[model samples]
Target: MVWDDFAINNLAIYLLDKPNKDRKVALFVKGCDSRGVVRMLQDNQIKRENIYLIGIPCPGLKDPKTAARGYYKDAGSVPEAKKCEECRHPNPVLYDEILGTPVEEPQEKDRFAEVNELEKKSVDERYAYWTAQADKCLRCFACRNVCPACSCPDCMFDCTKPRWLDKEVSTEQNQFFHMIRVWHVADRCIECGECERVCPAGLPLMQLNRKLIKDINELFGPFEAGLDLEQRPPLTHYETGDPEELM
Candidate 1:
């Protein structure tokens, strides 16, 4: 099976659910997908010994949806996928064997530009802006379904025992869902932008994730998720010297 796209974490579930414990699986991965593999490994969801990674150095990928719109005569005319536009890791960071020459990484740009702008707004203004965005949600779970960080075997949103969320889709419930999801992946998100890319509502989901990402960096010191196996996520790690602003 071939998936030609910017992010490939949607396929990660298959890797995590390997039927045979002794069987080894080989898979092709690009920059973001490789980080997803690392995510599963670091999260202890998968074993490195059971899989072989064939990494591809990605230059970038064009949005297939944009291409499907038929506005462009050539592939070059299609815009690079939003996920790839700010990709800091164009080469796979983890792999058993790699293919192709490593492409030069894209020039660094502020990943939190939208979050920074949102931060400039007053609390009420920010609340209003996000409320509007939340109202547009369809509760389709596209964002959560596409996220590699949302790898739970049984997601709370689907639970009937506790019924965490009401069946009715209101702005409050939608906002609550997003808030819970964003915080859950705050330290685990790989900055792949897949959630925003797949959203049919065109909601700026990445902005919400990046807001927490920016805060995490400032609060925990500079850290990028899914990069290093040795590194523990700031939220999971404790230090006596850590900031205690609320206390």
Candidate 2:
């Protein structure tokens, strides 16, 4: 019942230290969280035998900040999280035990609708739009911290040997940080939108992530990361027949 009250996708599983190999664990998962677990298993970060997944069909989650502000007259009137509104997968793809009857997944609509609109703008317009968004960045790293895909033992942001990012926060530095961060996770992003929700400045981080997803789909032919545990990420595999756009 606790899991039913909140969208567990907002919780960052990687932040928890690795569990003992002999210890078994059980947790509730929504569709996206299930994908995160699959990704961890695929990366050899966790063993499938060490965990039990209890799946729940997520209707959506209320925006906690909005609810705190008294934006809704009652609990029933609370708005769904933006990511949930656009979510294509509401039922867990993989689960050891399902807790409810499977809800019908949303119809296949243009998930990249916002990204497509951004693409229609002139190059300069797009640049200006992103620059303004980047200007508000605090370099807080909340986005990176909340991401399940960012499981590096030592993150590049914290590296000092080559100093990937400068200590000062500026528009240029923020832009570079976001650009590189998105690229690093581009092939693995599950589109849970936790990064945007956790952001203090309210940057539309999903738009940047989805843009990369759109490009990857077009160039590599409709690849969705974290959907199938057996599938290799498009960027991780090389094919001779791959498009020459980057070449």
Candidate 3:
């Protein structure tokens, strides 16, 4: 089935929330979206027997607005999201069938190079950088909606009981939103770079996601989620003699 944002927007909730079809059949899996699939399987949300994945090589999806460079030789489709630039795992790890040749791992995977330097700046400078970015945010959930990892039945923000964020987009609220989202999906985020693609605000969102990606590699002795369909994620798995990084 050819599913995109348009198809999803029209029928996703209906299909996902209530599936009347007899055959579960197959579905597409973007690397990050695979987190949702694994999680759904983990929670018995779906049966493995009736499901298969068709994976595509991710090219660091872009935020449509951020994609517009004034004068570029070959600036293809301009994605509106910013997360595409810093995406680390552009290749799919697991697939029944792949569409094209695998994307070569970059020699320099330091997608966080800019963010690291920004972190070294004075506290006020760092604050200024983020503030500028947050100011640009219209509080659109494009990042959250497009992300395959954000599969909460009801998101924390929608919780009027706690009211994590106000309707007004505050700096604290913006940071809070990103922080909660990353932690929620940290263990399962496959670094597919989808969340960064739909953002109208050109925030350096990948810095946060890449931090986890790099940390998982360094701390956990190289872990890649969604590579092996049979295997669950390492962070969710446990053994007696695990690496000392956790301690």
Q: Answer with 1 or 3, whichever has the higher TM-score.
A: 1
lDDT of 2: 0.81
* Alpha-carbon lDDT, every model: 0.83, 0.81, 0.59
Error of 2 at 131 (Å): 0.6
Report the lDDT tens digits of candidate 3 across residue range 1-247.
Answer: 6543222111111214535223555655554455555655654545666566676665454332443544435445444233444445555555578777777654656665765776688989877877777777778887777554556668888899888889888887887787777777666665555565456666666667766666667677666555455776666778776676743
Question: In model 1, what are the clashing residue pairs, if there are any?
Answer: none
Candidates' RMSD to native: 2.1, 1.9, 5.1
TM-score-based ranking, best first?
2, 1, 3
Give the poorly placed runs of model 1, Cα more than 4 Å off.
1-13, 18-22
The regions of model 3 sitting more than 4 angstroms off are 1-23, 29-45, 55-92, 97-108, 230-247
What lDDT tens digits, residue by residue, belong to model 2 across residues 176-247? 999889998888898888888888899999999999889888888887777899999888779998887732
* Clashing pairs in model 3, backbone N/Cα/C closer than 3 A: 62-81, 63-79, 63-80, 63-81, 64-79, 64-80, 64-81, 65-80, 81-197, 83-196
TM-score of predicted model 1?
Answer: 0.93
